[model samples]
Target: MVDIKSWIFKDCCLVFSLLCISIVGITTGDQEVLTNSWLVELSEGGEAAARDIAKRAGFSYVSPVLGSDTEFHFIHNAVPKTRFRRSILHTRKLKSHPFVKRAVQQTGFVRSKRGYKPLKGVLLSDLHINNPEIGQLINDEKDVVIGKDPTDPLFDKEWFLKNRGQSGGIKGLDLNVEAAWGMGFTGKGVTTAIMDDGIDYLHEDLKYNYNSEASYDFSSNDHFPYPRYTDTWFNSHGTRCAGEIAAARDNDVCGVGVAYDSKVAGLRMLDQPFMTDLIEANAMGHMPNIIDIYSASWGPTDDGKTVDGPRNLTMRAIVKGVNEGRNGKGNIYVWASGDGGQEDDCNCDGYAASMWTISINSATNDGQTAGYDESCSSTLASTFSNGKSTIRDAGVATTDLYNNCTTTHSGTSAAAPEAAGIFALALEANRNLTWRDMQHLTVLTSKRNRLFDPYLKHFWQYNGAGLEFNHLFGYGVLDAGAMVYMANHWKPLPERFHCTAGSIKKEMNFGTNEPITLTIDTDACKGTDNEVNFLEHLQAFVTVKSSYRGNIVMHLTSPMNTTSMILSQRPNDDEHKNGFTRWPFMTTHTWAEAPRGTWTLRVENIAGKNNEYDDGLFREWTLVLHGTRDPPYHHQDADEENQTKLFKVKRMHDMAMKN
Candidate 1:
């Protein structure tokens, strides 16, 4: 057999070397040099000539492989060879010039190109008061059983019934289900997709509420949603995550979910080598319908570095979904920030670090304490196991796949899904809200006073306010109650207004009842594709009209197309169906207020369709209406100036207009 250990060590060395080079280059200002930086091959024939030109240009690093290309990072400072000389000694003919990639421009860090590591471990007994070993660890003398045991005499078949309470089970833990229910979120009609190892659908606590219709097995392309029999160690990690989000309660069982009534759908993608990409593609294929909130507990190493390769494809797909997929009826993508602390050797924070998605960090049971058991010195506990288990006092508790009720586990991984469950509740409470609306409300509603200290010392200082939205706690442990309040009442941001036409030669008649237009001569719309055309125009001149007294709000309701219409009826079905077929249409008439507020008009494309579709099919239009105030204005803004600034930002919106 091949030496797996040696191979891993070699890969580590490669990563270390690249990291060192990047660090050294950045620290020494040598990053400005072309030779010392990462290089990308533009053309084959230009290899020798490019090298000579680069050498003459004082460039250091050069690579022919596109995967190894670093040209994207330094594109801002890169001097095009054509701008310089033409002779053999001073100039070089080009096959392909090093073009900068978009990621580098956006993030400044080079993406890692590493593969996935399959989880390997066994299922242990639930670590509760009943387990002597666990009881001793936490110094508990009382006997407490959090879940049911298959071998126990009290185990009954009727207990396995859907939505039934656990009669023979211990009165273990309460996941604050009543609070969630009171917030108007029962998770009814909502689906949560779990991307992790295969789930034991037969587990008593999970079986009742398990969604047989939504579960999918990406491990072997089989229709069976459960894990393969050969994988003897199929633990309860996925199952526990499911329970944390939607486990039924009230029948005297151990625990309950934040959204107990929500449906749990499993998508197993963590098993086998290089399965991450496959899982991501499968989830992306589902788009806006199959799943609403994607709860992911597993992530890269805790070292806080990114990796590249096919896995990037999945990241790209997720970003695509966040930006344009689901017809702008965006789905919430939740990722566990990782349990590793600053001292962990592997700097492996995965998709969480990406700005495209929301990263969830753990908090202890009090809903206020630290969720993971950090070392005395603030490092990740060395004994932390990635195996299937549960930890109760740490604020997280769940069932084990082995059917033994003797074990409990703790980790940021567990805490992440707990938050995801709360998000499910928020979604259920307010099904009319979009993904962005939900996320902003959650972050804004989170208490800044409850901020958790990060393992990396720098995060606290680098992140302002030391409260809301630190890289460590990520809006400080999601507040389900607060989120629900905002979800049910919050409104969408107003569409910003700008005059794309150089000057309105005609006194724009924006209707007497509409909001007035403040014309400014800034090139805000210049060079932008945000222009409306009667036919085939890249840009257009338009007016935004708003009514501040009616229930019709100018909510950008669809991601696929842009149009304007009047809502003459309540609960209109056309509101959901009028948008592009690929995206969910924003329900515009649901606002509490009728036509009254500031509205904006600009030129942009309807992006709800897939990239493969013809761009010509999308058309732009003018917008006129009124609606509710921006939801996050009061919470997210530090003051009135900040609120005004947010209001002034005019995005080239191509939202499907509501009728």
Candidate 2:
């Protein structure tokens, strides 16, 4: 009964206003501006007092009541740039000022984040042919069907399900979905939403399971998220992705979904050529309660050359979904890591690189990392995609645009929806799984990809617990049988625990040649609610100044003697005159590691064009750890009320942004 869409629009309007006011120092092509902005958190009192403080400083104030009460934003503009920064500094003396957080700029990416590491020998063209071995396999093994499954007359060619090796793919390299199906978990009762271009509900394979009530088209401003792709090969993307999630079984025209009995909706939003922060926020927050899992296969350009992610508005929406959707059980967010393997890093793109998303990478039918896929420390697991090497044109077979069926759908784009269907199966097994719980199950159940991996020696890192990891393959491929079994028996984890280190502001000078290291003691995580025994995610907020930002590199080391390649140097990012402005570099490499000692963040100015303009400072850094604690702190559904009204960002936004 609640008008959730209306609420989100109001919130987006609020953000637009705030951003318009908060961008005090940014310059347009024809303008020269001198302004300084600050994100101020009040020690006490209401927005009126904060506005009064802003008035006293002769500045403008804007408060976007995004669920938090103690924070407000202010801007002061003046000429003589020095006077701008100086006048803004005066707010630090305000009696109500508790924490005056400055935004830090940052850049760089780990190899996985950079999407630069390409598979040994792979091509870009998508092959539309069937498995090169399908014909031979049918003759040699007589049991292999040609056109469709014996039970579902139209599903026989879904080699990713029937026979992974039928076309020369690795034997048993598939997600092992058939084994789970035998166990009677067909993904019934669970629902998924494809947050992509659009889905063809009229397709014989997907119409039966389409849930229109939960769908919307932000791009065309309609509730029907139908495919509008007319002449291009790309328009079928969303339909193909959806078929992977909930294509009807037995009543099928194409291969069945990973979760055949599961319901799916297409919340089409990405139809246009350009998008703003508001459009994305609307798409992400659409009917959060009704949609159990949101499968998104898009993110900032994976060109491996750009570094960007969801701005403040969209991030708040994601946090809101995780904390409030699914009747407080939390919504599952399955994301495509990236398809920019040849040129970009997934870590450089905030969405796939965030600790909050289940970054799913692509593994080919032969069980190798896809050449076009991005690698990253944040990738939780992987799924099947087009085998780019021997099987250049072979892709996942699913329903296509015009109510058609095709075998050419590929990329991390296809991989994510497959994972989403798997998630639906997991959800059906245990509807109580929270977002974090799902992440734990993913990490615990995913089996290491022991296929013909060439980078095993270089990519492999022992979690010190015999559990192996590598940014290249995450925890390896998704084992459907393994994940579903674990999901059915999963005992909920303790409430989320957290801790932070090195909040002190410090300035470090960097010469053109020296590498500097900053250490912070995480002793605060001993036994409090913030204690961290095993890390799930770790973040570093940083600000830097550099002329050639691409020349910088950074790393973080744990007390356990493990090192994380947080930032790998990027060469193509030479066009930027700015360094990181409070950009967060995230890593999932701390898996199973304890956090109770000294942690180190190291920065090296490997090849900057100039340090003579030593105004560049390693301003300050804060290390945050999100892990687990025993006897979980008294749980409360603080975000529940937010479903009916605006939700405050509370501590999330304060730290999520430069504030």
Which candidate wins on TM-score? 2
All models: lDDT? Answer: 0.38, 0.64
lDDT of 2 by residue, 65-100 (tens): 343466554545542212212343455444434433
- lDDT leader: 2
TM-score against truth, every candidate:
0.48, 0.73
Clashes of each: 50, 29
Runs in model 1 deviating more than 4 A are 1-177, 228-234, 303-312, 323-327, 344-350, 366-395, 402-407, 449-451, 454-469, 495-659
Which portions of model 2 show Cα errors greater than 4 Å?
A: 1-157, 389-393, 451-457, 509-513, 605-617, 631-659
Candidate 1 on 1-659: residue-level lDDT in tens? 11123322444542232211112111112132121122233433345544554554544322332222322111212543222122232122222234322211111222211111233322333222221111111111111123322222211211211112232222211233334454346778788888776677776556777777777675544445675444534445676667666766553344555566788887776654333332454554443465777877665433322221124435445644554434466767776655544322111233543323455554443222232321111111111112212422222345445443212344655665666777777777677656556555554455443234434432322111111133334344454555665566666643222123333323332222232222223222334332211111011112222121111112232112322221111111111211211111112211111121223332122222121111112122332221212222433332221233333221111111121
What is the Å distance of residue 55 in model 1 from its true position? Answer: 51
